[model samples]
Target: MLHLKDGLSFKPGLSDLGALASHYTVVFLLLTHTCGGQSDPQPMVAMAGDDVILPCHLETAADASDMTVAWTRPDLSPKFVHVRRDRMDFLINQNPLYQGRTSVFNSKLKRGDLSVKLYRVKLSDGGTYSCFIPDLDKESTVQLVVGQWILRSLDLFNAAF
Candidate 1:
């Protein structure tokens, strides 16, 4: 069984699919810390199809201009949604669906923040997003939910079903 932090155990071997379905459950755990790490938490909540801001706040006084910062979706692990360099603008090298609709908060970046603003949100965009900055010991995540897009996806799913 693959034991997850959320009390979910995905058994590799199962007699029946129905039996396996009953074993999945979600558990919430509160995690707290007092220190230095490569990431921080910046959450964003927005209506589907509307723009939203995912803030990446660097709490400490860290000089991050030399670091390579990237915002990616964890669901699509190892895929970068957007990338930014020390002197370059936000570049959309991957994920064509996200082109022309994402940018970083300039004011925040000037203040050691690396938050990103996503426009024309889609249901597929709803997932755990992360900002990773190398060498500042920094990485942060923000949860995104595209409600309207989700509803639409669900409708399509049901119709297919």
Candidate 2:
């Protein structure tokens, strides 16, 4: 027996495979309908040395005051880019590489916004970042691409010459 926060309950009988399959299909359809619609992650491209916002928000506009939000990059050392709990930012385990370079929109948290601002984007910063809300069991990812401004400028200058 499995219970979900949305008041959905289902029990799988080991003796009936067909019944289990039907139950799974029903659950899938119910979940898709209840979730409204799927929104693709917004892609972001930024130049080196520039600041960028990585956006993440709940499907439903609900207060996130008590939610635990975590931003992480699996490929980076000291994985945690930022973490917030009980409406407070925690940095004890934050990656030193991102020290003084990351922040969340505190004012918008109550509206379910968990966007993060990353300063001075570096080449190494181009990667996938996960925004997770543990209590809600919801997560989303944002893709970041970092480009060199100097190279782009030089290319434009050479083309003009």
On the 0 to 100 scale, the lDDT of residue 94 in model 1 is 53
C-alpha root-mean-square deviation, each candidate? 13.1, 21.2
Tens-place lDDT digits, model 2, residues 8-52: 665646754464443332211000111112463334445777888
- Give the clashing residue pairs of candidate 2, or none: none
Q: Write the per-residue lDDT of candidate 1 for residues 21-95, one digit (tens) a residue.
A: 444332222222212243453333456667777666677755455556788876674467778886566564656
Give the best candidate by TM-score.
2
Q: What is the lDDT of residue 149 in candidate 2?
A: 32
Give Cα distance to truth, residue 47, candidate 1, Å: 0.7
- Candidate 2, after superposition: displacement of residue 36 in Å? 10
